[model samples]
Every structure is written in structure tokens, then in C-alpha cells.
Target: MNDMAYGALLPETPREFGFFVDGAWRAGHDWFTRTSPSHDIPVTRIARCTTDDLDAAVAAARRAFENRSWAGLPGAERAGILLRTAEGLRRRRDEIAYWEVLENGKPLTQARGEIDHCIACFEVAAGAARLMHGDSFNNLGDSLLGLTLREPIGVVGLITPWNFPFLILCERVPFILASGCTLVVKPAEVTSATTLILADILAEAGLPGGVYNVVTGAGRTIGQALADHPDVDMLSFTGSTAVGRSCVHASADSNLKKLGLELGGKNPIVVFADANLHDAADAVAFGIGFNTGQCCVSSSRLIVERSVAREFETILADKMAKIRVGDPFDPQTQIGAITTQAQNDTIMGYIAQGQKEGAKLLFGGRALDLGRGHFIQPTLFSDLTPSMAVGREEIFGPVLSSFHFDTTEQAIALANDTVYGLAASLWTRDIDRALTVTRRVRAGRFWVNTIMAGGPETPIGGFKQSGWGRESGLLGVEEYTQVKSVHIETGGRTHWIAS
Candidate 1:
């Protein structure tokens, strides 16, 4: 079969344009168009969820939780459903990829990879369901029995970002469902097609009514509703640090829901003079430029040892020049368009700010000449200090700020100076150096000689203001559950009579 024939089987357009509630699709009065960031064309018109829609989705999730259709299902049965969902995702991988590319302005190749990762997430969560076992003790005392069990934390509210709609949804929703909790997911307004498509796939995989729902709208309206919903027992959010703070405050003021947030990061890549400069430069490029630098964990800061700083900058600039930035569907495109116009402006503003702060713009420092779409050049800035705004803040765009350090201690200090500690990478062949750097870094996930090399098996989260709690692995499943202890008094009931 030809490539076009294969592509035809995939969903190029979002056929269903409504919120998924109570196991089916339903249209709303208001709808909004989702534009392709790469082409600046309307990809699909999705339902703009109102407060009523949010209430309905939340109510459905609450019903699913209270009715125990999901919570009371057998572990193996729930696992089977999840496994089927994963299989369905695999079968529709190409279509899901298309939707992701159209809605999010990521390259089609990256979108396909994201779809595969989403499937893996579901499969891992399915397997995790069987492994969610509790402990028991029979000889705690004479004729006494003790038991401990983990139960689902009721309804879950998942709010995902635009950059990685499908991947983030799978990361949170699968674990929530595996833990026997129903969910109401709110995808970012700019990128909701892939998420809505996944909701359909889940329904096709035999998820019951109210088990999973999707609401689409602005964060202020729909997302805030979910965050403040009293029935939502737990809330998992992936977004900016400012927005995450709002979620925390909302949860505290509302039902005090269990909150898990993966916020923004100005992640650093520290390169020592003795490090593998070739590998380090490649990793830095991928970490910062991939997804057009829209990822919260994107390594926006590069801290290089002064000895190798000049040579490394030359190599990095040469490499950044070669990266193709254009249509996301193109096979050769490495850096696609920025996800949104606001993000584009934000990125360019940072580039301008870097220039104003006296950082040398070694390469791109402006928007691309690409027609119509929100495209920005992959920017690299050198001669940066730790105090500069561009160096200190999370620029969520394809912009890298390089800072030179004289010693390993300074590198460590510079890397750990940011308030956000999501993830960081170190490039060094010396085992002692890698160990020392990894130990000193305050981030939740650290890499040595490699970056972004984990999947469902590895837990991903943040430290400090980067956010709280993990999102993958067994720890992710545990995060969605509550522990309960049971104790029984048998035989001798010697109470404290006089005490």
C-alpha cells in the first residue's frame, strides 16, 4: 500500500465535535475552531464547554464513582478494559498521530511517537492494576489480625497542556482508571482533537458510562470548574507554574482534593570541560528545541564549563542552523511551529529580552519568515549570566540561554539556582563527576550522558516549585489511591479500666 493509502485510513479531520460524557458524544451550543499552528488553518471546531457541560461531566464521573461500576469492577476485568483501550489506540495510531499533528503543531514523526507512548502508558497502567496488592499480618499480637488495603481516591480531574495533549492525557488518565477511579479530563483549548479522539477509542474499548469524560474550553472557565468541583476527589494538572499555583489554591479552597501538579521548568544541561561535547551538544539541542521548546521540562538553560564554552557554542550554533522548521507534517522538519500565537510572542519577547540584557544572539533571535503560521526561529544565546531574566525564567519556546561556569561547583550552583527543579541533564564521562552532579541537582529526574530516555517504567515529576508528585510507574498508581488500615481485637479484651 502507498503512503497516501495508509494515511487515508487515519483520521485527518475530527469527525465528532462535542464533549464525551456518559460514554457517548454530545454536542453543545457553542463551538470553537482549533487551528493548526504549523499552517494557521482551522483543523476542527470543538465544543466550547460551558459551566453546564463541566457540571455534567463532573456529575457523570461522580455517578461512575458512587455507582461502583468502575470502582467495583474486578481488577482483572478493569485491566482487560485498559488493555483493550491500549490495543485500540495502537490500531488507530496513525489516525491519532494525524489528529495530534493537526491540533498541536508538532512534527508528524513526533506525533506518531507520542501516540505510541500513549499506548504504552495505557498498557503499563493495565498491568499495574493486577499488581496493586495490599499487605496483611496475621501475628500482630495474640489472636489479633491486621490488614492494610489501598482504595481508589474517588473521582479524578485531569487538566493537560496543549504541547502534549495525548501523551499527558494517557499519563494521568490511565493511572486514574487503573486505580478504579473515574475521570473528567480537560484538554487545552488549542489542542483537543487528539484527546477527543482518544475518548472515543476508550468508549469503543467498553468503558462504561460516566467512567471517563472530556470537556473542552478555556482554562479559566472549564479548567477552573474542574479544579474547584467539590465532587472531584483528586486533581492532576500539568501546566505553567502560575496556573499550577492557582490550581493548588482552588483545590485548597474547594474540596481540598488530592493535587498532583507537574509545573514549568527552566531545566539546565551542565556540560563539563571533560564531557563528551558531541553528545552533550546533541542532547541539549533535542532537549530545548524538540516540540518547539513547548514542554514544561524542556532544558531551556545550558550551563557550560568556561574551558569548552566557545567551542561548544560554535558546534551548537552550527547544529541549530541545520534544524528544519516548517510544516509539522513534513518528514524532514525537526522544529515545527510554536503551539500558539501567544507562545510565539512569548518566545520572541524572550529573545528580544535576551538581546536587551546583553546576551549574544549567536544564532536565531526572531520569528521565522514561514508564511501565516506561528513559527519562531530556533534561538541560541551565549554570554549569559545567571541573573538575566531569560536565564532565570522558563521561556517555553525554542530559545536556549547559555551560561559559562569556571568550576563544577559553580555549574552545580547555577543548575540548582532556578526555583523550578523538574529535570536536568549532565554530560560527563567521569562517573564520579556524574554522581556528584546528579546528587547535587535538586530536580526530580536527572540524566547523565543522556536526556529524556525514560518511559512508563520511569516516574516523572518535579521538585520545589516545578510541582509536586509523580506521574508514571508504580508510584503514579499509588498516587491515585488512599491507604486504609484495619485492626481486630480478638480473645482478651483487657481495656484500660483505671488508666
Candidate 2:
């Protein structure tokens, strides 16, 4: 890779932003500027909020939930607001994508697709608001009636990570609102712009003041505050597994608020000998290359049948080599800069460790310099054992480790060997083999012949350490709600005491 000129996509000046609270933008005690990860230029200046600010936001959400300003609305009205917000997102998709690319270091094309996915999330949530229902027992005695009611759990706290900032936020927001819960969101400080901008969209769409709030700052302060706040009824966090454990501890120490977490993953991509080599190779390339491999659900492990292992590795390496890695603004660039310097160093460290641990470097192991900003070539390692650190840990970069299995049983066992079970992909032309592997693999989301497939229509979560609860689809709306069983006498009241 050679030096590439920074294009006009770089903002000449940093855009100033304020935290949203009670339907208004408020200044913090301090402020900080965020530099674009790809261009290495100041992109946005954000308020540096503190725990007190988080408290204010939580209080506002609590008030809104108690007053029913948003919760009191009819299902049709809430759905209408969500639909309008979706339209607003469509209107500003380009601008949002630009900000996403600059701050997150993902390609412009991928960011645009994320915006579209966000829109679909809102749309699906709107339908769920209308269609979501509880159950009634009609078989009870004539004088007795039994019904189960699904009600909003109350104030919800949402903590989102830097990777897929707006996408993850939208995946939960509309659904939380649809469940009639007020929420306070704490987006990753590095990528808070889009989440803050969403405040305006929701307000313009007729959402009540205090119904939704955002506090921007470091996670240790604000995020911990959300977890410990007694008034918060639920907390949904998306980030690393270590932090997810901290969240669990905080919840237990505090109110034990309902927790919804989408945590870390060392997902696997298994390819059988009977699979289409071309399609499997392509999907494997996309699985590790997408988002520069920063995604939690990214398939970092390649488990292929030993018979086709050499051939498949060759095809996959060729595909990875041809992927364009350059400026995020460049439409032709398939892979962009690493999101942060720390992540870049981490990936490089893993590359070194793989070699030191005796795994053969099949393809890339060097970093690329494109003028400025951090970038690494798509990496692949072969002869990887299940015990290798690179094979077990989540490197969270454009790195793929390969393992060979002689039989389907070995492939399935290798895939399930990891503690993290976020997702897995199986490539096989044989339906029986696909179904068998899919059943045995201990992953939450499984794809046959594809990787990272489907949309907001289906539910997604982890199996073991991947995190608790689902985030999308009809189940998404229900996650923020609690169930209450109600019993009534239709004709006469039955007294336990003799009267």
C-alpha cells in the first residue's frame, strides 16, 4: 500500500455537538474533540458529560415513564412516530453515512447500508407495536378470568459500543419505545454524533420531551452510573465480554435491573468438503473482511474439511488479497482503516503471537501505510490449533485463523470449543450435513452457505458467553417489557374466608 491523498470527505472544521436531555441540547462541564480514524482529522467536538449528567438524563427518563407522556399514547400513535422517524433517517442517510465513515473508519458504502438497516429496524418496530400481544386463558371456570399483560418495564438504559454505533442503537431504540418505555442512551464517546442527531429526528416525529435522552462521555463514569441507577428498570449493553461481566456485577450490586447484553464473540466459519468451493471461499472472505473485521459476530475461525482445506485456503487468500484497502471515502475501497490505534496495535500483536506460537502465516501479516491513519492488510493464518491464542481470542480486526478437520464431528466440535457463541456459518451442499452441523454448533445465529445473513425480521443473540437476551425482530420489542398475570371474577367474588 502507498500514500493516498486525503479527499474532500475530510471536514475542514470540527462540528460541535451537545448532549440531548429532556428534548433539548445541553452543554457539559467540559468538551472534547474526536478525530476521524481514517483521515486523522478533527471531525466532531462533543460534550464531556459526567455521572451527574447521566443522573439528570436518567431522572428525565424516569419522569417521562411515570407521567406516561410517551407511554400513554395509543399503539397507533407510537407506531406513527416510529414510522416518521424512519422517513427522517432516509432523508439524511448520506449525511449520516459520512459522519459514520469519518468517526468509525468503515467504508462509505457499508455505512450507507447500515443507515438503510436502521430504517428497516424502525419500520419493523412500528409493526411490532401494533401486532405485539399477550395471552388469555379462556378455559378457566365461568366465574373466573385469567389474562397475561405485557407492560413496559419502565426507564431503560442503553449503552452502545463504537462498532456499528447507530445500527445497534436503532436496533434497540424503536423497539424500546414501542414497548412504552422511556430510555437514556450512552453511546461510545468516539461515535456519539449519530446517536445525538437521532434526538432531533425523534422530536420532529412527535416524541415527547424526556422520552429519549443521550449522555455522552467515558463509559466508566456514565455507563456505570446507568447500571447502578436504581430508577432504571432495564439496561441493554453491547460491547466486550469483560465489560459485560462488569455490567452484571453492577446490576447485582444495585437494583438488579433487567439486563440485555450483546457481548463478544470468537465465531467460527465451517466449510465442509461437499460444499461449493467458490461460494464458501467468497463468503469466508466477506465474513472476515467486512467492517475491517471489527464486528462482534465476525467469523474469525475457519474450520474446513482437511480434504479441501488447502484448496479452500488458496481461494480465500486470493479473494482477501484482491480486496481494496484505502481511504474510507473511496467508493472502490473494500476495506478501510482500523477504527483506532489501540485496535491496530492489538491486531498486530496477535499477528506476531500467531507466528511465535508456530502457526503458518498463510497471507497477510504486515501493516499498510496510506499517507496517515492506521491500516492493516487482510490477514490469514493456517495450521492453527484450537488452543492457539489467536484462534480462541477475539482479535477484532481483519484477521482469520484456519483449522482443518477430517470429519464432520471434528468440525462441529472445533466450532463449539470456544467460550463465546455469538454466531457461526456452515457451508455445505448437503442439506443433511448442514442441518446436523447447525444443530450441534453452540452458536446463537447460524447461516447455511452464507455468512452474516438475514435482517431485523429475525431475532439474534448468543448461546453461552455471547450475552443475554435477543435484540431484533418481535422478540426485540418484548425484551423491554415485563409480564403481569391478572385474574378477575366474571360474575361473583370467591372469598377464601367463610362469610
Candidate 3:
């Protein structure tokens, strides 16, 4: 009934954490159990869906799209469903948030915030359904009436990641629905429960059967099917750049499906000497440390002016040390356990690489065991060169690598050095400098004097190898629909081909 009771009221392992297909919950022929990141206990025995299962889910989505049962619903009706879905998520927020903490190994506070954002994604997308529009073209000439029709791209396959699973789904699925497309979702195996719960809530909210299907398993089998399925029109994936490349290739080999990928980031945050030192320090700490630095837009690289580098690093290290790394369920905890042993290894490996590359380890590289959970102290590195692995690569963990820059040009150069252009931040008192730096940075999302500042309304994605296609905003809504241009002879046809 209340907040604290939710941890008990919510199931640690649900009786049925199965696939949702054709408006019903079903299990796969095979299954695998997930041990919690918060604590190494059984979270759920998730369905180990093969390509065959993926095929069935895709078929369901295809049928729904072809039948126009869900996809053909009027925008207003669709909007109503989306709005109701948002409300449904609201009702189950605490439960879902708890699960996020358990599975993701993020603090409960951060999990709650993610839940709020997820709710916002659906609510904003409800409005997007009505706002999806095409343009009228009169410049083509008065004799011809020309316009474009924006229509859904048919069945879409969604492959989401473990980090921010609920938020990514909300970012993707709602917009896909808003554009009148049916979905076949493959959530990350580590965090499949929340999505299953979401499917159930959608059913309760009266979502049409077969409109939103789920197939859970390893990304290799399930996600590969989605990418390569001939029936799937689009593949929206959020994961690492390497996996995203695989999705592209798979799509090319099979359906040649449209792709919406929100991939990995080695994002940069620059703090000029003119900026407020404390404020800059705060942003830097939170940017790299929030969600345990397991975000596409995590400001993992901080480029500070050489004049203030020492002071900033001291303040930043102090803030990082203050971050409480403990049980995710504890509301007072700032940093939770590493999501999985594999991720913990990856983080520690990166730390080792940073050391190997001669980056100065300023603070925290020790791993701790919080009961059975895999825990690590927040890691920090200074005197990092552009060529260093720590500075260039994306280590999706609670790690921060700092660099010193003497001039704006050097700062911009350092920020833009990486192949990934997912997101970046700049902290400066000068608005002019902020604007200039923002324009120069190649990332899709840029935060001036702020870090990881965006909501459901703000578009988020990457440029280079980080991945493509934006999420949220009107642009995000537009990404799900294809445009068809039409021309009609109103007065008479004027041929430009011949006289």
C-alpha cells in the first residue's frame, strides 16, 4: 500500500516471468534464471526464447499491423491507450522501481527517477500520436496539388539494454505506437522482469491483442532474429556499438529494416575556468557517477581548464568519495552494486587498462562484496592523455577520467576526439562560449552548464559510431513513420518532359 511495503509486496521472483504474446503470458520451450545484481539471488527464471519464439512474436506483430487492429486505431484512440499506459506505469511505479534497483544495481532514488522518466515518455508520446503530421507543398506549382502522408512503418523489433531498461523501452515503444506500428520487443536478459510487467499492464489498459509482443532471451538469438527477420520493418536497438554494428549487418542481410539505435558513449564534459568551480565539480561527479556511469550519455571524460584542474580534481574526488556505495534497496545509498559480475570485470578491466596506459589513478579501484552483490568503489583517473584507453573508451561503470586543457580550442579538440558522439556537456559562465562550444561539439545532445539534462521531450541519440536515430521530441515521433508524397492534377497537367 505504501512505499516501504513495496519491497515486500513486490515479488523477488515472480511466479511467471514469461513472454507476452498475442495478449497473453506464455513461457518459452527453454528458460534461464537471472541472479540479481543487487544481490546474487534468483531474480527470475526468464524464458530462453530462440529464433523460433522470435518468429512467433514477429508473426503476431505482423498480423496486428496487417489487420490494423492496433496499428490502424485512430490517433485519438491510440493516444487514449498510451495515456492509460502512462497511468498504469504510475500506479505500479514503486514496484517497478524496486525491480530496477534489484536488477540494475542502481540506487532506489535513481531507479525512482528513471520510473518517473519512463512515465513521462509514455505521456509525452500520447500527445505525439495526434501531432504526427506531414507537410503540404505549394511551391511545386499551383497546377499540381502536392502533399505528403506520414504512415507507420509496419512491425518493429525493439532490442533494449540492461541499463535503464524501462526508460529505453518507454523512449522507443511509445513513439513506435504513436506512429501506428506494432512491436516485437526483446529486453536484455538481465532486466526482463520490468518489461514483462509492462506488457501485463498494457493488457490491463486494453491494448489490442498481438499489437505489442515480447520474446525474452539472449540478445544473440532473440535480437538477431529481430534484426534479420524479413517481416520486421524496423529494428530499434539500444546497446553497445559493436552489437549495433551487428544489428545493421543483420538488417542488411535480411529485411534491410530501418534502424533506430541508441548505442554506447564515451561522452565528454568540459569545465572552463570561468565556470563556478563547485557547480562544475558537482556536475562532473554526478555526470560520471549517476546510474553508476552506466549510461550512453554518461560524462565519463571531464576536460577541465589547466588553471583550475587541481582544485576541480580535489573537489571532484571529495564528492566521489562521499558517494555511498552499498545495497541498492537502501534509499540512503548513492552508488549500488555493479549490475553483474561481467560488468564488474569490465569496469575493473578498464581500470587496469587505464593504469597500463599510464593514467594516474587518483582514487578508488577496489572491489567490495556487499553481502553477495558485486560492489566497487567509485574509480577516478587524472592526467589522462587522448590516446589513453580510459580517456577514449566507454567503460560503463562508476569510473571518471579527467584531462587538463589550456584553451577553448584544446577543450573542444579533446571533447570531439572520440569516434563516439552520443552526448557531451560544457560548463561555462559565458553564454556565448557555451553556444560556440555546443555548435562545435559533434554529439547529438549537448548540455551547457549541465550534465545529462534531458527529459521525454528532448531528443537523444548519437552521431558517429555511437549509433543513429533520435529518441523523444517531435523528431523522435517522426522517426517511426515513413513519408509518402502524393501529387494531384488540380487544374491541368503541365509537362516539363516535352513541349
Q: Quick one: ranking by lDDT, best first?
A: 2, 1, 3
What ranking of all candidate models by TM-score puts the best one first? Answer: 2, 1, 3
lDDT of 2 by residue, 281-382 (tens): 989989999999999999899999999899999999998889999888888988998988888999999999999999999999999988778899999999
Candidate 2, which ten residues in sequence have the lowest lDDT sum? 1-10
- Model 1: how far is 355 from its true place, Å? 0.4
- Residue 309's lDDT within candidate 3 is 92
State every prediction's TM-score relative to the real structure. Answer: 0.96, 0.98, 0.95
lDDT tens readout by residue for model 1, 170-238: 888888898999999999988888888888888889899999999999999999999999989999999
What's the TM for model 1? 0.96
CA shift of 27, model 2, Å:
1.2
lDDT of each: 0.87, 0.91, 0.85
Off by over 4 Å in 2: 1-7
lDDT of 1: 0.87
Model 3 lDDT per residue over 123-157, tens place: 89999898888989888766777899999989989
Which prediction has the highest lDDT against the true structure? 2
